[model samples]
Every structure is written in structure tokens, then in C-alpha cells.
Target: MKNIYILSIGKVYRKSNNLYFIDKDKNKRVIPIEGINAIYIMNKVSLTSNAIQMILNKGVPVHFFKEDSKIGTFYYLGSLLPKQKKPSGKVHIEQVKAYINVEKRSEIALEIVDAIRYNMIKVIEKYREVYDYTKTLRNLDVRKEFEQKMTDWKDATNVIRGIESNIWVIFYEALDKILKTYKLERRTRRPPKNEANTILSFSNALLYATVLNEIYKTHLDPTVGFLHEPYEKGRFSLVLDLAEPFKPIISCRILIWLINQGIVKPEYFKKDLMGVMLNENGKRVVIKEFESRIRETIKIKGKGRKSMLIFIRKQAYNLEKALVEDTKFKAFRLVY
Candidate 1:
């Protein structure tokens, strides 16, 4: 199953038992509902009630993104599987219980932070082979020293977050060195200031949505989280938590690859008062590459070679086991 991205102005509707999309230019495309994992609408598109119902019944999610927005809005039907139907409630209860228990929450948060740190270091190390990032790696060593003092901190969560933030700062420093055209002085969001920040913002947003889709396949609650505080409104904090480690492994790597390979050019972006953002052409190229990368297989211990999407779903299952079964929850790590 693959995700179908609608990057054109179109109307999607159900015809007979099949789904079809007709663009404003009268171009028609058939969408195979059974083979679809999700639908991402990044441009102006309309979905008929019948089409929406069809996708829901097939257990497919629709992710909507506004132009130049960081995150996508999600719409999907709740789980329909008989086994998940009853266990989902129990799993959610266990999830909330783990959150309310301070020790458990702290443990989970620490694991997440460790995963993030490990991945960030791996990314820097990978690029160091081709680029002169000696100063950047030395700065990372200093950050590691601060991370060692984390145990003595009173607020473990806040301290762990600080460590994560500092790692990102150092990682961006490394990126600045590797990128020939773009200078990533600092990480920025809510309208990323430069091309590097724009790519990072867009790529991370896609990762968040991908993680959320995986979470929907499991019994875990998306609103309740470990590393990030759970909120009743806005942000799915749990998605934010799970997406942290993968940001370096997936999004950051993709950004460097796209820019360095000349797959994404300066002409692909536009700068306005709001900030720098990918143009329509840039979005198409990035989304196509992103989808291809996720589907590519990698060798993972015990699991052998598996696609990134499977690993993401496995991570969700790992969290569920940790919460409900009192098993160890290992965050996904990139193999160097």
C-alpha cells in the first residue's frame, strides 16, 4: 500500500465501487481505494461525502495541508478491527496511567531523548566522512558533557528537553557547514526564514503526519505523550514525541540529500514577508522523493530488512507494549 498525494486542484468522488479525481483542467485519474494507505491533499481539492465514506470504510486516512503550512490536518475513521476495538480503550487507559505516574513518564521521556541524541550524533558522524565538520563535532562533544549532568537535574523532563534542543543547535551547525548554498544559522519554524529552515520545517511536518498515520493503526492515544506535554487542544504531542528521533534520520538526511544532489534548487523556493517556502514544483519533487525514501527497505536488527513505514508502525507497537504489557519500549534508531 502507498500514500496518494493530490497536488492539484481537483474533485474526488466515488463512482460505482471505485474512486476518481477530476482536476480543474478536466484531467481524470483513478484512485484504487483498496491499495491506498493514505491520501495527502496539499493543494485545493474537494472530496465528496461518498468518497469520504468509502475511504473511511476502507480504513484510509486523509491528510490536508494548507499552502506554506508546517503541519497537516488529519481526518480518518476510528479503528474498525474487532481485536483493536476492545483493546484500544484498555491501551488508552494504560497510556494515561503511565503518563500520570511520574517515574514512568520520566523513564519514557529519557528514552526518547536518548534516541534523539543518538540519531543526531549519527547524522553528524555520517556527514563528517565527506565534509569537514571537525568544529561542529567538537561542539557536539561539549553538548554531550552537559548531557552527562542531566541526572542531577531536578526536573528531568525539562532537562532532557534542553539536551534535545542543544543537540539540534549543534546539528544545525553541522548542516550549515555541509550546505554550500544555504546557511542554516539557526533552526526556525512558524515560517522558516531560509531555504534550509524551509526544507526542515516541511520535511518534519511530513514526518509528524506519517507518524500520526502509524499511530492511528495502533491502540495508543495520539494526544497523550511522554517527552512533550499532552494537550487537549492543538498539537498531537504524542506524534511530536515519536517524530523526534526520526527527524535527524529521515527529514534532516532528506534535506541534505535534496540540496546537495541539486534535486531541489533555489528557484524551487519563493520568499515573501511571511517567510521562505517551497513553490508548487518544489513540493512535487520533495513529496515524490519523500514517499520513495519511506518505501525503501533498510536492514534492521531482528527485523531484517524493512521499509521505514514498517519501522514506524513497529515503534508504535513498541510503545503500546511498554505501556500495556510493561515491556521495554525501544525508539527507532538509524543504523550507521
Candidate 2:
């Protein structure tokens, strides 16, 4: 039910009637402006200040990305940090304790790491024959087996960082898969060669953006993070927090599906002066794949009536409620 108007082409303007108007050929059409949560301006779509103001009044932010897919800026008129309420000392101590609790709560965080790592490993294996990087990592797995290890990870922090290390290896391996899966005599950037990689990255970006958006409304400070550092340009700590729960379950699943279905291959990306880049065609292929992924849903474990999207929104709200009510905060733990 969340509506996102993706403006990849053309321009839009706001009318006096409080409607957004767009031009097609020589005729003007009214774009459905209601129910829109955000507008993504891809390829730097132009718009008037009046249009921007109208959108801000409606509580919809505008996301601008450069032509090369770099994050340009986010235009949300309100201050995300304005008049912030501080958590009481008791509440703050409780949050840290909840995070460190040696119970089901601690296991909840560990589960997220394991799920994400497992899915990343699957992606590498799925495309093992295609990419050299996959082959290298796969070979390393064989060699590392001699080290011998028990599967159980007792410490939650150790479990989380350990899984992340393995996931990074798989991420590079997946990138390699895209490079070798396709066959072309000369690499060209006219269109992206690896549709799978393009789509996966796009999907991750969207996921991260959503996390950051939700964090702004919560009592949890977005800047303070554990795994991802709070940096100057991209202080995306909150996104990292949210992605911890979803990496293996959603991102990894989409990667594996693309490889198995032959939806994307090495031919989808090309090497250029910039190293590797997706062509326009590849971008379209991946965007479509990402759309399909967003639509894919998992049944929420509890509250049988609600879907995953509903579950995610509720989880964000719950964090805020917990903080305001001076209760412990629990992060979402993905079971599958």
C-alpha cells in the first residue's frame, strides 16, 4: 500500500488545484498525488519549488540520486532531530541491559546475523560455476573445513561480527559471479552487463533508506550505531541496524533467485574506466527484479493477520513506544 512515485524521466509541476501535473507529448495529465509516501528522482528529474513545498506539506520526502546512481540528497522539510526527547537514565540503562541480556532477547540479535550470513553463502554457492570470485571463496571454504569448528556461537556480538565477515566474502563472490556469467568479446557500458548485481545493490539501497527513515521517528538516536560507524557524509547507522535483521532473509534470497532463474548473468555488466558499471538496460533489469523482491512477503511469525510490511512498520513504532514508556527495546529478529 506504500506508494513511491519514481521519476526516472520527464518533469512534474504542482497546479493551483493542489494536484501534480505532468506532460505527455503535448497534453497534460494529473499524476495521482495522494497516498504517496515518497518520490524518487532518478536521473535528476526537474521540479518546481512550489511542487517541493507541496510535497513537504503532505509529509512526503524527495530522494534525489545522481545520474550514476550516487545518493544526491534527501529533501524532507522538517528537522529529524528537532526538539528531541532524551531517554531517562533508567531507560538508557535498561536498553543496554536488554541488548546484553543472556536470554531469548540476546538470541534474537544472534538469529539476525545467522540468517543473513546463511543466505549470503547460498548466493555464492548458487552461482559457483559462473564467477571466479565465487570459485575462490568456495575453494577457501573447502580449505577452512580442516580448521574444524562447532556451529554454536555463544556470544551474541561475536556471532554478529563473525557472520558479517563471512557475508562480506560472499558479497564479493556474488559481485564476481556477475562479471563472469555473461559472454561478450569487448566489455561495454552502453548497458549494464550484470542485471543481478545491479538489482541486488538497488534493493539493498532501498532497504537501507527505509531503515533510516523509520529511525528518525524513533527515540533511538540514528547516529549511535554498533556495526556501522557514524560518519560525516553517510552517517547511516540506523540503516545498518535495520539491515542486520533482513540481510540474509531478503537480500540473499533475491540474489539466489536471480542466479537460479537466469534472470541475470555476467553479460548484464561491463568493465570500463570506472571499473564496472551497469548499463541502462541492466539498470532496468535490476530495478524490475528489486520491485519483484519488495513485493515478495513472508508471513509474520506472530499476529497471523499481519504481513511482513505491517510487521516491519509495527516494529519501528514499538521501539519508539518502548523508549517513551521507559521499557526495554528489542530489535527485530528474523527466524527464517
Candidate 3:
């Protein structure tokens, strides 16, 4: 199954069980609902009640994004199928229990941090093989710095988060040195400061939604998180947690590839009161590449090969197993 992205102004409606999208220009396109895994609306698109009901009944999630906002709204019907009918309350209970237990929560938080650190190193290594960024990486001493910070880590999630943030600072510094066209001096959002920051914000939003979609298919509660606190209402803290490792592997890598290959250029971005952001065309380009990257297959040792989307789902399942069955949870690691 694939995702359907509506990037232009359109009206979506259902006719005789078929989903169709008609752009403002009256150009109609047939959307195969059965083949759709999700729907992403990146622009102003009106949806008929019938169309919304059909997708909901079909168990398809619709993610909506505003041009100015990175994190948007997610719409879905909750637990429609028999398999999803009774999501194991046992899993939810265990997840909350683990969260309340300081030692267990700390262990999981460290695991997530380790996964993020491991992938950051992998990303640097991959770039070094193709580009002469070794000097920048060495100067940053990412691994050594992270190790030193870890030495002072306590059973506090806030400290773990602090260490994670510091590592990203080093990673971004190396990234700025490697990039020829863009500079990400520091990570800024809610109006990303520059082109690199703009793309990073957009990509991370997409990844958050993708991980949340996968979480819905499992018994894991998206509300409670190990690394991040579940303090904000309506915020999927667990999705934020799972999205950490993937940010380096998926969002950051895609940003690097797009900039270096010249697939995304200055013309793709524009500045407004909302700060620098991808134009309509820019959004389409980024969405196309983001979808392609997630669908791309990679080989795993015992698992043979799997798409990035499958890996995401497996991560959720692994978390469920760890919480409910008391099994060891193995976070997804990028394999060269």
C-alpha cells in the first residue's frame, strides 16, 4: 500500500465507492482507496463528509499540514478491525508501569539515546565515504563528547534529553561544515531560521506522523513515553520518542541528499512572516522524496530485507514486547 499526497487545492469526494480528487482547475484524479496506506494533505483541500467516512471506514489515516506549521493534525478511525478491536490493555498498563518505575524508564531512555547516537555516527560515516567531511567530524569529536556526557548521566530523563541535545549540536556543526549550499548554524523551528532548518522541520513533521501511524497498528500507547514526558495534552510523546533515532537516519539523510544532489535549491524556498519555508512546489518535491526514501528497501541481517516503513512498525512491536512480555527491546539500527 502507498500514501496519497494532495499538494494542490482540491476537493475530495467519494462516488460509488471510488475516491476522487478534483483540483481547483477541475482536473480530476482517481484515488484507489484500497491501495492507500495513508493520506497527507499539505495544502488547502476540502473533503466531503462522504469521502471522510469512506476513508475512516477503510481504516486510512489522514494527516493534515498547514504551510506554516510543522506538526499538524492526524485524523483516523480508532480500532475498526477485529485485530485492533481490543488493543491489549495489558500492554498499556505495562507501559505506564514502566514509565512510573524510574530504573525501567531510565533504561529505556538510555536505549533510545544510544540508538540515536549510533545512527548519528552511521550518518557521519556514510557521508565521509562520499565526501571529505572527515576533518569536520574529527574536530567535533562527536563520539568522544557523547561518551563523556554519558558518564555523568543519572536516572533522570531530563539529563538524558540534555545529552541528546548536545550530541545534535555537534552533529549539526559537522553538517554545516559538510554542506556546500546550506548552513544550519543551530536548530530552530516554528519558523525555521534558514533553508536547511526549514527542510529539517518539514521532514521531521512527516516522520512524526509516519511513526504515529505505525503506532496505531500496535498495542503500544502513543500517549506515554519513556524518554519524553507525557505532560502535554493531545501530544503523542511516544511518537516523539520513537522518532528520535529516525531523525538522523531518515530526515537528516534526506535533507543532505536533497541539498547535495541539487534536487532542492534556493528557488524552492521563500520567506514570509512565517519565516523561511518550502513553497508549494518545494513541498511536493520534498514529499515525493520522503515517500520514496521510506519505501526504499534495505537488507537486514536475519530479517533479510525490509522497507523503512516496516522497520518503523517493527520498532513499535518491539516496544510492546518489551513492555508486555518482558522481552529485551532492540531499537532499530541503521545497517550500512
Q: Which candidate number has the best TM-score?
A: 1
Off by over 4 Å in 2: 5-7, 16-31, 69-160, 167-196, 217-220, 231-233, 265-270, 305-308, 325-336
**TM per prediction:** 0.87, 0.63, 0.86
lDDT (10s digit) by residue, model 2, range 30-123: 6556755445555535667777667666666555654452321122222212233544455445445444444433344444444444445544
Ranking by lDDT: 3, 1, 2
Better of 2 and 3 by TM-score: 3
lDDT of each: 0.77, 0.51, 0.78
Worst lDDT run of 10 residues, candidate 1, spans 71-80
**Cα misplacement distance, residue 141 of candidate 1 (Å):** 10
What residue runs in model 3 are displaced by over 4 Å at the alpha carbon?
A: 69-84, 129-155, 232-234
- When sorted by TM-score, best at the front, the candidate numbers are 1, 3, 2
Cα lDDT over the full model 3: 0.78
Pick out the ten consecutive residues of candidate 2 with the lowest summed lDDT: 71-80
Local accuracy of candidate 1 as per-residue lDDT tens digits, 1-336: 788888899999999988999999999999988888778787778879999789878878787766634321223223322123345788999999988876778778877777776777677775645345544444444335445766754566677677667767667777777776776678777778888888877778778878988888888999999889896457888999999888887888888888888777878888877678888887777787788778989997677898988888888899998998876678887763
Clashing residue pair totals per candidate (backbone < 3 A): 0, 13, 0
